[model samples]
Target chain A: MFEGLYSALEQSEVITLYRHINPDCDALGSQWGLATWLKHRFPLKRVIVLGHQKMTNGLFPDSDEIDDETVRQSLAIVLDTANVRRIDDERWQSARQIIHLDHHPQIEHFADLEYVIDHYAATCEILAEFFSTVDQEPLEADVAEYLYRGLLTDTLSFKTSNTTEHTLAMASYLAQSGLNIPQINRDLFDVPLKEYEFASAIRAEAQILDEHLMISVIDQAFLDRWSMTASQAKDQVYQFGGIREIEIWAVFAKDHDDQRNTWWAGSLRSKTLPVNDIAMNYRGGGHKNAAGCKCLDDASLNALIADLRRRLKENQA
Target chain B: MFEGLYSALEQSEVITLYRHINPDCDALGSQWGLATWLKHRFPLKRVIVLGHQKMTNGLFPDSDEIDDETVRQSLAIVLDTANVRRIDDERWQSARQIIHLDHHPQIEHFADLEYVIDHYAATCEILAEFFSTVDQEPLEADVAEYLYRGLLTDTLSFKTSNTTEHTLAMASYLAQSGLNIPQINRDLFDVPLKEYEFASAIRAEAQILDEHLMISVIDQAFLDRWSMTASQAKDQVYQFGGIREIEIWAVFAKDHDDQRNTWWAGSLRSKTLPVNDIAMNYRGGGHKNAAGCKCLDDASLNALIADLRRRLKENQA
Candidate 1:
C-alpha cells in the first residue's frame, strides 16, 4: 500500500512538505516525521517543511523558506490535509509532483497520488505503518517522537472514537525507538500556569442549565482579563468536557466590530447529540457532535440555548 | 513464565482474589481480569473478589463477602499489593495456598508463590501477557475491558515513565477482544460535574511562589464552601501538574484534630526534584517526585514553604 509513496520518495531529488493552515500538532508532527525520515534516508536530497504559521506552543521549529524555482524542482507531499484550499503553502501547485497523505475524508483529488484513509486515527498512524513496512531498521528517536506526538494528540491520548488496535500497534511500533514517552506527553499536553488558571476559571464560572447542558460565556471583560482572543477563549470549551452530568456544553466569547457593535462566536460540543443543525441556525456549522456558531445578540443567544435544550429533550423522547 | 500461575489455577478448585486496600483501577483490574478468566475456564470453581472499601468513583462493583471456612479451602491470589499489611482483607492467611502477582517493588516475602515484576507498567499488563500465553482463544470482552481499565489508568493512558513497547503491545492484545476503547476511557476517567468544578477551583486558587514552586492551601473556609474533606482537597494537586514554569507544586488542606486545633496535610509533587526528604521533615514521606506531609501550625507551614523554596534555589545553583 505504501509502495507508491516509497518509490516517489526514492525518485525525488528534493521534497517539500505542507500541511493545512492553522497547523495542529498532528499536521506538523506527521509532516516533520516524514521529512526527518526522508532526510535521514537520502542525505543528499533537499528536504523542506513549508508553512506560514508556527505551532502556537512554539514546541516545533519554524517552517523553512524556499523560492518558487526550488518549489518547481521539488516533489510536494502534503500531510494531514484533505482540501487544497486549506493547504498552508500553495506553492505545491508549482511542484513537479504532488502526493497527499491524510486521515480525513477525501475532500478533493488534488494530488497525483493520494493516500487518504479516514479510518486511521491520525496521519501519523498511517505514516508509522508505512515506515515500518518499508524499513527494516528501527525508526530514529526523533522520527518516532515526531510521529508519536501526532498520534497522541490527534486521538487525545488514545481516547478518541477512531482509535483502534492499529493505533496502539502503531504507537507500539514508535515506542521501539526508545523515545521518552512521558516527557513527550508533558511537552505536548502541559498548559502554562496562566492557561491553567484560565481553564479553571472557565470551569468554575460555567453555568449548568440542566443535567444535560452546561455553558460558559467569556465576554469582552473576561477575555481582556485573561489577555486572550475570542478563538482562544472559545477553545476552552474542552474544560467542560467529560463531565458525567454534561451531555452538551458550549463556550461563547464576545467580539466587537470596528463600529463597536458586539456579537458572540461560540464553540459547541456534545457527547452523543447532533449540534451542527443548531449551529447552522446561528450561521455556523461543523460535525454532528462538535460545531461552531455566532449569536448576534442576547436574544439570539437565548434562542440558540432553547434550540439546544429542545434538541436534548427531543433525543430523550 | 506464566506456567506456574496457569498450573496453580488449574489445580485449585476454589480461588479468592485480594488486592491492596483503597484499591485503584490497577489493583481491581488485575484481580477481576484474572478472576473473570478463571471463572470462564473453570465454571465449577468458586471465584471471589474480596475487599472492604469500594472504588471511589463506583465504576467497579462492590467486593464480595465470604466466610472463613471458604477462605481455608481456597487458593488466595493477592494482586497489586507488595505487602500483606496493606491487603484489604486478612483472610489470605487462612487460605490453603497463597499466590501473589504485582507490578510494585517487593515489600515482603509473604505469599507462597510470588510473581512480582516491578518493571511492568501495571499489574494488568502482566496479566494480559499471562492470559494471552495461557489461552489460545481471545479474551472475552468483559475480561479485556477489566484489564484495559487498570492498564490505562496505571500508566496514565500510556504516558507514564514505565510505559513501553510491551505495555502498548499488551493493550493491543486486549483490544483484539473488540471492547469499546473510547467508552471504557470515558467510564474510567470522566469526573462528575462537581468534581470538575472542585478541580477548577483548586487551580484558580493556586499561588505561584516562584518559578519552580506553586501551591494551593484549601483552608477550612474553602473546604466548607466546597463540602470536601482535607484529603479530598489535597488530591487536587494534580490540577497544578504539567505547568511549564513550575517544577514543584503542593496542595495543603486544613484538617481539625479532636482538640479543635487545625493542622495542614499536604501533597507535594515535582517534575524532577526529590521531595520525600522535605516531606520527612514535616512528618510525612513518599516517592522522590511525589510526597506527603503535615504542618501542625501556621509557623510550620511557613517553615515548610521556606524549606521548599531553599531546595529549589539550591537545585538551581
Candidate 2:
C-alpha cells in the first residue's frame, strides 16, 4: 500500500511535513522520524517540517518557516493528522503532491496518496512498519528515538487498550537501533513544579458524589483561586479518573461561546458504562468509556448530574 | 550461568517455585511463568508454586499443600527474592538443589546456584531471557502473560530507571508469544473501588512542606477511620512520588512492633535528590531515590521531617 509513497520518496527532491494543530508527541515524532529517515537515506533531498504551536520544551527542532512557493515545489507529507482541516499549515494544499500517513479513523479522503492504519496505536507505528519494509539501514538511532517517543506517549507507555504484541515488537525493533529509553521516558513525562502543585490542588478539591460519581468543577472561582484558565484546570481531569471507588467521573468548567453566551463544558468518563450515549444526548460525544459534552447554564449542569446519577443507579441495579 | 539450571530442569522429576514474602506482581509472575513454562515443556515433571500470602484478588493461583517429603524430592527455584529470610516457604532448603533468579541488589547468599542481575528491571526479565535461550517452544501464551505482568508492574509499565532495552526486548519477545497486554496491565494496576477511594482520601489530606516536599501522614486515628493498616497506607507513597513540585515526599503511619514498641514507620522518596542519606541517618535505608525507616515517637518523626527539610534546602542550594 505504501509502495507508491516509497517510490514518491525516492523520486522527490524536496519534501514538506505537516502534523495536526496542537501537535502531540505522536505527531511530532512521526513527522521528525520520517524526516530524519528520509534525510539520512536521501542526503541531497530537502525536507522541511512546518507547524504553528509547540508543546512543553523545544526538544524537537523547530518547524521551518517555508513560503508558499517552497511548499508548491515540494512533495507535502502530512503525518499523524486525521482531519483535513486539522492540518497546521494551509500551505500543504500548495504542494505538488500529498501523502497522508495516519493511525486515526479515516474521516476524509484528503491526500492523493493515503496510508491509514487505525488498528496501529500511533502514526509512528505505521511509519516504523513502513520504514522497516523499505531499507533498514536508514532507520538510525535518532529516527528510532523519535518514533519510539510517539509510540510510547500515544499508548500512554503501552497502558492503552490498542497496545498489542505488534506495538511491543515495533518498540523493541526501535530499541534495537540504540536509544536511551530512560531519558526518553523522563523527557516526555517529568512534569514541572507548578503543574505538580496544581495537580495536588485538583486532587484535594475532587468531590465523590453518591458514592459512585467523582466530580471536580473548575469554575470561575477555582480559576480565580488558582490563577489558571478553564482549559488549564480541566487538564487535571486525569487526577480524578484513576480513583477506584468512582465508577463514573466528570470535570466541568465554566466557559463562554463566541457569542459571549455562558456555558459549562464538561468531560465525562466511565470505567465500564457507555457515557458516549449520554454525551451524544447532550450535544457532544466520544468513545464508549470516555466522552464530553457542554450545557447552556447551571440548570443544565444540574440536570446532567441528575441524569448521570440516574444512569449510575440504573447501571448498579 | 543458567547452563547448570537447564540441566537440572531437564533431569529433575519434581520442581518447586518460591517467591518473595508479601509477593508483588513481579514475584508471582516469575514464579508462575517459570512453573507454567516448565510444566508445558516437561510434562512428566511435577511443578508447584508456593507462597504464604497473595496480592489483591487471588488472580494468581494458590500455593500447593505439599509436605517436606515432596519438597526434598524437587529442584527449588526462588524468583524475585533478594534475601533468604524473605522467601515465603522455608521448605526450599529441603530441595535436592536450589536455583535463585533475581534482579535485586544481592543482600544474602542462600541458594546453591544463584543468578542475580541488579541492572535488570525485574526477575521476569532474567527468567524470560533464560527461557528464550533454552527452548523457544516452551514460551507459551500463558507463560508470556505471567512474565509480561512481572515485567510491566516491576518497571511501573516501563517508567522505572532500570527499565533497559533488554527489559523491553524481553517484554516484546513475551508479547510475541501471544498475550493480552491490556488485560495484564489492568489486572496488575487497575485498583478496585475501595482502594481508589482510599487513595483519593490520602491525596486530599496530603500536605506540602518547605514549599518543595509533599508529605502524607496516615496516623493511627486516620487508619482507624479508614480501617486500614500501616502497610496498606504506606503503599500509596508512589502516588505522591511523581508529582512535580515535590523534590522529596514521605508517608508516615503510626504502628507498633511485635515487642509492643510504639513507632511511626514510614517510606521516603525523592525524584532527583539524594534521600537515602537522610533515611540512613534515621533508622531506615533504601536506594538513592527511595528508602524506608521507623521512628520511636512523635519527636523522632518531627526530627526526621526537619532533617528532610534541611536536606531539601541543601539540595536546592
Best of the candidates, DockQ = 1
TM-score of each: 0.96, 0.91
Any runs in candidate 1 off by more than 4 Å, and if so which?
A257-261, B257-261
lDDT of 2 by residue, B172-202 (tens): 7887776766567767777776776677778
DockQ of each candidate, alpha-carbon based = 0.79, 0.53
- Each model: TM-score of chain B? 0.97, 0.93
Cα displacement (angstroms), candidate 2, residue A185, comes to: 3.0
* iRMSD (1 decimal) for each model: 1.0, 2.5
Q: Name the candidate that leads on TM-score.
A: 1
What is the C-alpha lDDT profile of model 1 across A3-116, one tens digit per residue? 999999999999999999989889999999998999888999999999998887876788999999999999999999988899998899999999989999997898899999
Best by lDDT: 1
Cα lDDT of candidate 2 equals 0.84
